[model samples]
Structures are given as C-alpha cells and as structure tokens.
Target chain A: MQAGTQKSVLIIDDEEDFAHTLAERLSLRNLAVQVACSGAEGLAFMEQNLPDALLLDMRMPAMSGIEVLRTVRQKYGMLPVLIITGHCSQEDHDRAQELGVQGYHSKPLDFKELFEQLVEVLHQK
Target chain B: MTDKHFMAKNLASSTHELQNILAIIKESSCLVEDVLQINGKPRMKHGDKLYHSLEVIGEQVDRAKVLLRALNSFAHAVSDGAQTCDLVETGKQTAQLVERFVRLKEHALQVVVENGSAHIACPPEEVIEALHSLIIQAITACTPKAPVLLRLGAQQNGQALAIIEVAGAAWNPEEMEQLAAKAGGSVVLAPGVCTVQFPCAASL
Candidate 1:
C-alpha cells in the first residue's frame, strides 16, 4: 500500500514476541507498524514521529500502559490510543474509558475484533 | 420427624460422611506414591513446609470429594441403591478442575514459572483452582509498575515437592495474612519484597 493510503500504527508492549507478531500481522494488512519495548521508548518514538493510532499494553517493567496513555493524552490531546491488556478487569476497562482510550482489547487477543475497532477509530479520527 | 424420614436423613448424612473419608484415603495414597517417585535434589530450604502444605491441600480435596459423594449417595439412597465409584480418579479429577483456573491466571500475568514439573497427586484441576486463588491474590497485592517475580521450583532439599514463590513489593502484613488464610497458604515478608509460597507435591 502507498504511504498516504496506509495508516500508521504504533504498538507499545513489553512482550517482544507478541508485539512483533502483531506488527507483522498488521503490516501484512498494509498498515505501517512501529513497535516500542517500553512505555518510555514509546513516548520518545511518538515525540519523533506521530503515528495515526497507538496500541499500548497495560502492564510493563517500568512505566505502565495506563501511565503511557496518561502521558500521551497530556502531550497530544485527541490522539487515538488503544489499550491492550492481558488481564481485562472491570477496573481496568473503566479506567481506560475514563482516560479517553479510543479502544481496549484483552489477551489472548481477538484479532478480528481488534482490527475492526482499530479501523473504526481511525475512520472516526 | 417420622421414623422412616429420620432413618432416610440419617442414611444420607452417613453416606456423605463415608464418601468424604474414602476421598481422604485415596488422596493420601496418591501422595504416598508421589513421595516415593520424586527424585533428585530439592531447592528451597523449607522442604517440610512444602510437603505439609501439599498434604493438607490433598486432604482438603479428599474431604470435599467425600462431601460431594455423600450428596450423590443421598440421591441414590432415596431412589436407587448404593453404587460403586472410582474415588481415586474422582479425587484426581477434582484437583485437575481447580488447576485450570490457576493456569489461566498464571499465563495471563507476567509471573515466571520456575522449577521442575512438580505434579500433584491430587487432580491437576484442583491444584490449578487453588493456585488460581493464590495468583489473583498476588496480582491484587502487586504495584502496577513493579515486577512480580514468580518462581516455581523444588526446595533445595531432596523432596518430592514443588514450591511456588511470588515475589513483589512489600505488602501489608494484615492483608497478606488475610489472603494466605483464604488461600490456605502462608505469606512471608522477605528482605527485599513480599513473598507468598504455594507448595504442591508430586501426583502419582
């Protein structure tokens, strides 16, 4: 897909394998995908090159997904961000909604649902 | 109550009690088999504690099985006759059922599973179920950003037992004690962090 036609997605997750696999899958669908191993790294990358949407993992070593989401919201208001988490509790879901997360998905991920949500968010934006 | 009614109720209660006793015997037998088969050196210092915990958990499973059997027997007594059942497998199956819950939580979280494959004599299901409760408790106690290091391995001593150690930020003594009590496990505050240990014995 051409650069202008394809949407850019930034995946921020601690799980290297899961992140890579996801990036590969999304890339196959003709989306430009960039990955960061941690929340801090993700923030730095976002500063340099803003993606169309960010897919963030909730749990991590240093800064959490929620922390990253908070930072992203502060720096770039109205940025479309998706919170991806392994454990999806009610509290997490509620918090993600409160923090203006554009989407949320629990692992083991439902790729179809995630893709649809990502497309919906990008279209709206 | 009428004589017939009283007799029926008494029979039901006795049947239930008998089932529970039989379950305990079967679980104990499996544990004995595990103790015999386990080979090599253990890792943790508290071998006895791990063994005792596994035994106790097995015993509890047996008790639950017996109770369930009694309920089943009461129904049979009221309608059909007493039936022969495989209590050993029942005990094992029950353990397995509990383990499923534990396995799901363990995989979803960032905890590491260290150690040799320590199978419980009781059913894999039961161990997982009990472990699930313990895992959830640990997850709730952890700080969001802090790393929760989970170690599952044998004690340093030569024993047919497995230990699950969840290490994280220092937890409230009261809260840890409450969680431990609920999960039938012990919680200790280690030097650098809080640790909860869940012991499982080999399953025959």
Candidate 2:
C-alpha cells in the first residue's frame, strides 16, 4: 500500500463488461480504478490522469494493445504494464517480453493471481 | 496448409470470442462472491449455498476452458500440411473430441503408449480423422462394457504404430487403405484389431 492515498490503476480493454467489472472489484480494495474501452481512449485518459499502473488488453481494432504499449513505453518508460489477452500468439508474447512488460495473462483469468501481481507491481513504484 | 484453413480460422476466431465471454462471466461471478464476503464472511441466509454454487460455476468454467482449448488446438492442425506430432497426445486429443459421443453409447476410450513415445510425420488432421473413424467403428463392434483402446508405440524397425483394438472386431483392414494412405500409413486387420502403422524414418 502507498503512504496515504489509494493507488490508482488504469485498465485499457475494449471489452466493456470485463474492464468495468474488474475495475469495480479493484475499487473495493480502496484503489481508484478507471476504464478505457479502446486503445485511443486509454491513451487520451493517460494524458491527464496517469494512473500508478496499467492493465492492458492485447487485442483491439484500429490501435492494438501493443501499439498502445509502444506509445506508453516511449512516453512513460518505467510505468508498470501488465498484459491481459484473450488469445495471443507466440510472436506477440515474445514481442511483449522484449518490450519488458511487467506481466502477461490469458483470459478467464485467475483474479487472485492477477490481484497479487498487481499489488506487487504497485509496491515497486 | 489444407483446404480447411478457412474453417479452422473461423473456429479459432470463435474460440477467442467465446474465451472473452467466459472471462467476463468468471469476473462477474467473482464480483458477486466478493460482495457476499464483505464482512469477511458470506450472507446470513444463503451465503453458504451461494458459495457452493459459485464453486460449481468455477469448476464448469474450467471444464469448458479445456474443451475450448482442445477445439482451438484441433483448429491449429491446419497450420501446416505436414508436420511431426506426438502420436500419444494426438490420440488423447481425439478421445477428448469424441468424449460425449462415447459416453452416450456407454463406451470407454483409453490411450495407451507402449515402450516409448511414438512420433509420426503427416498431416495431423488426417491422422485424427483416421483415428476418429476407427474409434467409431471400434465403438460399434466392441462389447457394451468393453473399452476402445488407442495404442501407440514404435515398430521394431524404428517405425511408428498406432492401433485401436475392438472386441469382436470384423472390419477388413483393406477397407481403410485409401483413408490410411491419406496419412502415409497402413492398416493391419486381425480378429479384433485395426492398426494404423507408419514409417517413422520417412517423411512425405
């Protein structure tokens, strides 16, 4: 936990229910959670309310999660980013690894494990 | 790749979509469970029942995930026209694909690997189809309580063999030559057996 206030997390995922539901769950832990339903929207949100960490979904139309990651890396290099994907190929996984993402997970995610990883990443800041 | 690439691609896409759907359901279920545990315990009246039911949902989700993964894997066989694959694993996957059908018939399916692992070079989908056809035949011929055994191993001359044994089997192996040839393999007919054998040392 941070010193005084709740740590904030920004979730970038096109899946509306998945993003909001997860955000609501994390909010119960006393953290501020925001959801962006698209890569563009997430980037736009980050321009002002840069959260402590990011939960990114890999597959999206127009601008993909990897594209968003690339932009974030260039703009906010040290921010912790965890990838949550429905179906990612080996090539994409390797690319994410090369880009030095904090973590990667598949769909029908283990919420407990995801929360633990999120906490660990937040504490590192 | 085979002509089935389009179909496989569609299946792969559908599995991903369904996976996302499952994820949302799982998270929504967890959210409900979380609310019920606000006081570090469940609701006063139906908390325990709700928790148990949630557990059942979780287990079913896990089960459905396995089937989805298998379907996705089966779709992936179209990635190449020819490749080397573990025969034992292929048999197990084939068995899983036909599980519901076997259960409806009250038949058992088992994969038994002998001595060592068996590797075969061929279009994996073709082998699966061949094995699938054999299993159907085995189910029809075997005794009600008998199992359909998918046995895989290496031949004496470094060849690989996979056989499905049926009780009271009577299908002539010659009937499967055209089918087996599609997999670069052959069939051996016996009193209660149908074996598909391939030359491991060679590749087409």
Candidate 3:
C-alpha cells in the first residue's frame, strides 16, 4: 500500500451520506474507496476484496464496528483499521485501542487530519 | 433534625439542583448555537456561492433562534418545577425544533399524530429535548432525499411515545438497532421501514 498507488479502502458506516461523502473524498485523494452501509456488509465486502485499509464506524446496527474489527483481525491478522465514530465514548476508545486499531477519528470528521492519518497508515502498510 | 438545620439543608439542596439545571440548559444552548453557526457558514470560497451559502445559513440561524427560544422557555418551565404540563404539546414543539435538520437535509418529514391531546405528568423540557435528539438522529440516519416518517402518539398502555420511521433504500436494521441501543431505546425493522420508538417514561 502506497500513496498515489491504486490502493483500496473499505468504509463501514451506517450514515450513508457521510460514508459516501468520505468515500468520494478518499477517491479524490487517489485511493480506491468502497463503502458498505453496515458492519455486516463491510465484512462481506472485505471477504471479497480484502482492502488495504478499513475505515470503520464504531456504532452500527446488527454488527458493531468493534465486532467488525474483531472479525477482521481474526481473519486478516494485523489489517489497518481507522475507527470513526460520532459519539466517541471512553469505553469505545479504550476498546478500540485495546484491539490495536491503527487510527481513530471522531465525527464530524476533519478531512485534513483524516487524510494525513490515512497517508501515514498507507505508508506503514 | 431541628427546624433551622432542616431549612438550611433544604436551601442547600434546592440551590444545588437549580445550579445543575442551569448548567444543563447552558450546555444544550451552546450546542444548539454551535450547530447553527457551523451550518450557517459559507460552503465555498467563491463570491456568489459564498454569499448564497451565507444567506441560507442566516435563514437557518434565524430558525434556530426561534427553536432556541422555545427550548429556553421549556427549560424555564421545567426549572420552575411546574407540576402539570401538556406532554403532547411539548413533544410537538420538540419535533419542530429538530424539523430544521430534516428540512436542511431535504428529507420529507411526515408527522402523524395519532392521539389528539394526551397529557402526561413529567418534565416537559427534558422529554422534549430527548425526543428532539432522537428525531435528529433518525433524520441523520436516512439518505438525504429519503422520507422520514415520524409518528407521535400514545402507546396502548397510555404511555406517550414518539416513533421515528425511515425507509431508505439502504436502511440497515442492525445499524439502526445499535444506534437505538446507544440512545437508550430499541429499533425494529419491517419490510418497508425501520422504526425507533422512544417512550416518554424512558425519557423521564
């Protein structure tokens, strides 16, 4: 995974507009981005594509972002995940950190910070 | 305890409660103001687009001011310790407060009031504010152009509740359920729509 390369990113968030908007932003930044509107869908998409990075939303319906993170780690060990959430409770932050999330951002997202973090993550990967 | 000690303790408790209520009102008002200011800012740097965005933002801020006033009054009423208030009216007012967000996103909001006029004994402001947050969450959960159907009515058990239903093409039941759980409620998804019910008692 490298900057300016066609690296893929998977976004799992229930907020459709926010997810699409973020995907569009990521695409503009030269990353191939695919969005899943739920954790389940994100997991399914990951199984198919195995993206370079995953931008996960912590709060989602049937499957939570944490649950998705655990599943991804179990399947694809050491995959980079950036946890994004609207309500960033202490519990969620602690859990995400404990689970070894590569990056964490709170909503409403600051695109500049997110882009910088994404670049760093991609470089490391 | 002696009368003097009892009176002093009562005064101290009342003062503490009032301070807490004021803090809540202040915090909520600050959030409302921030939302207005953020949404009111120009979306672009270009002259004409900036101007148009500012104008739209001004209108939204004005609308938000009205809502803030209503919220302020409601807060006052609750702080005043009003024993009997109209819960249904409070619910409607709360819905209106968050209606701006729905309209801003260009979502069609269909509010169905099944119960004409039912009164419940509770702090109207708290219930209204909670409901407003719930509606805002519901609106945010949907697609920009999707219709958000809100049903405000009394439950079969005579407990007032507000039901927000959204039928987006990509409505995720599990995501909604998680959101509901976070909001201290639950969500049920049907064939066409997903509904989140916030009971009045729970709000209290």
Specify the highest-DockQ model's number.
2
Clashes (backbone N, CA, C under 3 Å), per candidate, total 30, 0, 5
Model 1 CAPRI rating: incorrect
Candidate 2's C-alpha runs over 4 A off are A1-7, A49-52, A120-125, B1-3, B40-48, B76-92, B108-121, B147-172, B175-178, B185-204
Better candidate number, 1 or 2, judged by TM-score: 2
lDDT of 1 by residue, B1-204 (tens): 656446656665555445434433443444343544454326558867766776676666555554454344333333322222122232233333333344454523233344434432233222333444444555554445343344444332222222233445344568656655443345566533444443444221
TM-score of chain A of each: 0.92, 0.95, 0.94
For candidate 2, list the clashing residue pairs, or say none.
none
Per-residue CA lDDT of candidate 3, range B1-204, in tens? 655345544553443334333323333333344455556744544746645555565455445444544544455455445544455566667766777787887886777787775555555655565566556666665566778776766565445556666654344566656655553445566643545444445335
Question: Best candidate per lDDT, number?
Answer: 2
Model 3 C-alpha lDDT per residue in residues A1-125, reported as the tens digit of each score: 25647888998988676677667656756799999999889988887899988899886879988889889889999888998764444467788888899887655444567779887887789
Candidate 3 docking DockQ: 0.01
- Second chain of candidate 2: TM-score? 0.81
lDDT of 1: 0.57
The weakest ten consecutive residues by lDDT in model 3 chain A span A84-93
When sorted by DockQ, best at the front, the candidate numbers are 2, 3, 1
Instruction: Give the per-residue Cα lDDT of candidate 2 at B153.
Output: 75
Q: Write the per-residue lDDT of candidate 2 for residues B1-204, one digit (tens) a residue.
A: 445888888887898888899999888888888887886784378768879989888888877876776676677666533476667667677777877777788877777877466777866677788777777766775677677777877464656788878687668565577677887778877877877887663543
- Model 2 residue A18 lDDT score: 93
